[model samples]
Target: MEIGTLQWYPGHMVKARKMVLENLKLVDVAVELLDARIPMSSRNPEIDLILANKLRAIVLNKSDLADKSQTEKWRRFFSTEQGYPCIVLESQLGKGVNNLIAAVQELAKDILEKLAAKGRKPRPVRLMMVGIPNVGKSSLINRLAGKGSTRTGDRPGVTKGKQWIRVGKGLEMLDTPGILWPKFEDPEVGFKLAVTGAIKDEIINIEQVTLKLIHILSMKFPEALKNRYKLEVLEEDPSETLKKIGVKRGCLISGGNVDTLKTAVIVLNEFRAGKIGRFTLDELS
Candidate 1:
């Protein structure tokens, strides 16, 4: 069967995209956050156009949850290959965040020096956080400010408005609504976003998403699945494998059949929470 492109654009997201453009004028650079587990998919394609001609520092957030080797490769790809300053970050743990700070500073070095040369006091560097929904933008802001300056939640669109907050001695950040592109050119992008909880589960069929996830995981990291699910052997059929997992985890219905929905939910949440293993869905090779 042939797969076609998938697109998801809520009316609010159109407004969000416009808001991002309006707010971009107030900031010197954008701290674009990407989910480390699926770096490519997490990136909103419109971000390149949205942040054009401005300095950008890429923050691969949730680094602790991704394969270490793949994380390093992405860092190099962004910093060396793409020539953008990039840093790995674990917003939940405060790991590799100092480097993000350094990278931002490096991005604004010339502008700072120019301000100093003009006989004016260097002002706080205004930064904007831009990313697709549920990519940890709020947590990163909180981690930087050392306080809950913005609304932090586990779901997409938690930040429905834009506001400025002081984050450091010479840093201010603009938190805007998380914006997504109007259409996903590749179908896998939608699946990847769905798998990571960026897209609302209510809008997608969880069973199908979970099936795709299982298919990918079973092919790439079957050993991790084996250990996590306690399966002696994996079957070629991903549906069969998931049923075995459902039975092991006791997601059974009244008829003693595997409760696939309940089992799928568990698999997705655990994978997002990094219980299965450190994985990189967007591997370089």
Candidate 2:
């Protein structure tokens, strides 16, 4: 399957956009969550337009799975260059939760002061969490709320509707369904999204995506492939390398042939799980 042929935009995403726009009036700030590994690809480009004029901050979730040095560069890029307050987060473990709250509150401090000056009662900062599917928005919300206030899954499009949940004092968040744009103009973006589990595996050709991943790792992180799969040598062909990995891991079918599908699944799962190595696919050149 050609990477360019992969295009995913369900009708629900259209509704998601409407939902976000309607709720924008209730939000003081818009927090955009991006996967730390594929920061560029994981971002919903339309978010900037939809959240325009609203105070915005970025949270780089799943930082533990991305290259540490590159993550730092991205942090500087978004916070310093892009002029959005950025926070590095490992949402699964609740790391950086406090920092996120502090940063957001600081961003809304002026608004809080304005209310005080007007003799109006102070209210918690209302935030709308937005991001592409499977970018860890729900996990971050759950971490902040200190419970499973929203349903979460490893797959994409898990959150179907919006829900408002109050975190501790001075913080309330509106959780919305993940939204991807109508189409990907760049094929590499689609491949990155698919490789990172932002797109559902059932809808895409996993074998092709895995081959692309192997080719990328072979060039950029050869040592990771060797170390994780115990491959002493990698073939020039990614397909051959995948077969070698299959043989090493014993993914064989009848007649002792490598089960390419199973092998692809394994490689993709391991890559997403960060078992291969910490990587940052969207390198800043």
Candidate 3:
């Protein structure tokens, strides 16, 4: 949010790319799980190009946190532009989940039919769920499996290795470690990820990120901030808005001083978990 320029080079990225390429032949389709709030930023360009020619389906995860109309626009955009079947799903709530499975089946229909024609029992469609860190891949897998089948947490990089999770009779998912791009070519991309909590806050300055989010919301989504916090929209300064939030939210010290840092954390946590409201960081326009 605060013009995030930090870059993370997890050793896992190299391993993830190698693993994906090595297992590409085994996978029938690539089910890319993207955050509904920041679909473009949540995507890993290297992974996209690596799996380019293969059958791919885009699963817009965390749909509940994002604007419904904007999510629809993204769904249509991906379908039209990339020719990849896209499905909107709240992996946490299981919304639009059946549709995700159906999309995968539709995309892999050719391979299924081929197996059937060969007189061999049609095996399950192998799919790889890939996305940047904290995009909710594990939660989605757990939801689809109807149990705590995958390790999940609020932070990023929870899933470190690969595991094959069986969703149903005809669907199997290869759960890979959440991977972030080595370098963010666009500064806005880094900012969006930070604002959306896809990037770890410890790696970046939370106070700065929160201020950046305040500015962005002021410009594009002032109404959201006003409605959520019941604070008057003012052009005074982001620091002033942050202080007001701290005072209003009772994030004050015993000395009656507003703790701006504490207030920033609360705002960011709420926004990331969708407690603030259904908002989308990126617009189609």
Over 1-285, each residue of candidate 1 has an lDDT whose tens digit, in order, gives 112223454776778888788777777888888999889999887778888988999989899889999999999999999899988999888787778777787788889899999989878787878888888888887777775344322323424354667665567676553455534657787788888888777777888888888999989899999999999999898889889999999999999999998999999899988999998888886
| TM agreement with the true structure for every prediction | 0.89, 0.91, 0.87
What are the per-residue Cα lDDT tens digits for candidate 2 across 1-285? Answer: 365355445666677778778777768888888999999888877767888889988999999999999999999999989999999999999999888988889999999999999999988787877888888888887788785343322323424354667777778787553354534678888888889988777778899999999999999899999999999989999999999999988999999999999999999999999999999999986
Q: Please give, for residues 10-116, the per-residue lDDT of candidate 3 as tens digits.
A: 67567777766765655788778888998888888776677867898898988889999999999999999878899998887888888988998899999889989
> Model 3 Cα displacement at 52 (Å)?
3.0
The 10-residue segment with the lowest total lDDT in model 1: 151-160
lDDT of 3 at 106: 91
| Order of models, best lDDT first | 2, 1, 3
Candidate with top TM-score is 2
Q: What's the distance in Å from true for residue 114, model 3? A: 2.2
Clashes of 1: 0
> What are the runs in model 3 whose C-alpha is more than 4 Å off?
1-5, 10-12, 147-163, 175-183
lDDT of each: 0.81, 0.84, 0.78
